[model samples]
Target: MYPTNIKMKKKDKRKVAKAVRGAIKAGIKENIKLFLNTKKFGRIILAKLHI
Candidate 1:
């Protein structure tokens, strides 16, 4: 959740939504690959999203 002071107008919200969609479409595979390669404490995090 964002703070109340950070108010987003409808137009700005639409632009952000469009950019996020485009980024996800273009970089989803690369993002997942990078995430999987990330390591902490000699262990890897395996995440599953249930839709």
Candidate 2:
């Protein structure tokens, strides 16, 4: 598989980080965030872990 190109500069990187930080600050749980981040392995694993 070939690598897909995604472009970012330092400023863009900071903006993305800031957005993620804001989300974290706004009451989003770390586990839920992790599940969302997995891109497919959704809440099932996290739910099992938490239970």
Measure candidate 1: CA RMSD: 11.1
Clashing residue pairs in candidate 2 are none
Evaluated at residue 4, the lDDT of candidate 2 is: 75
Error of 1 at 18 (Å): 0.5
lDDT of 1 by residue, 1-51 (tens): 766787799999999999999989879866765666686522244444312
Q: Estimate each model's TM-score.
A: 0.44, 0.41
lDDT per residue for candidate 2 within 1-51, as digits (tens), equals 976786788899999999999987765677556756586566555656765
Off by over 4 Å in 2: 1-3, 28-51
Q: Tell me the spans in candidate 1 whose CA falls farther than 4 Å from its real position.
A: 1-4, 29-51
CA RMSD of each candidate after superposition: 11.1, 12.0
Q: How many residue pairs clash in each candidate?
A: 0, 0
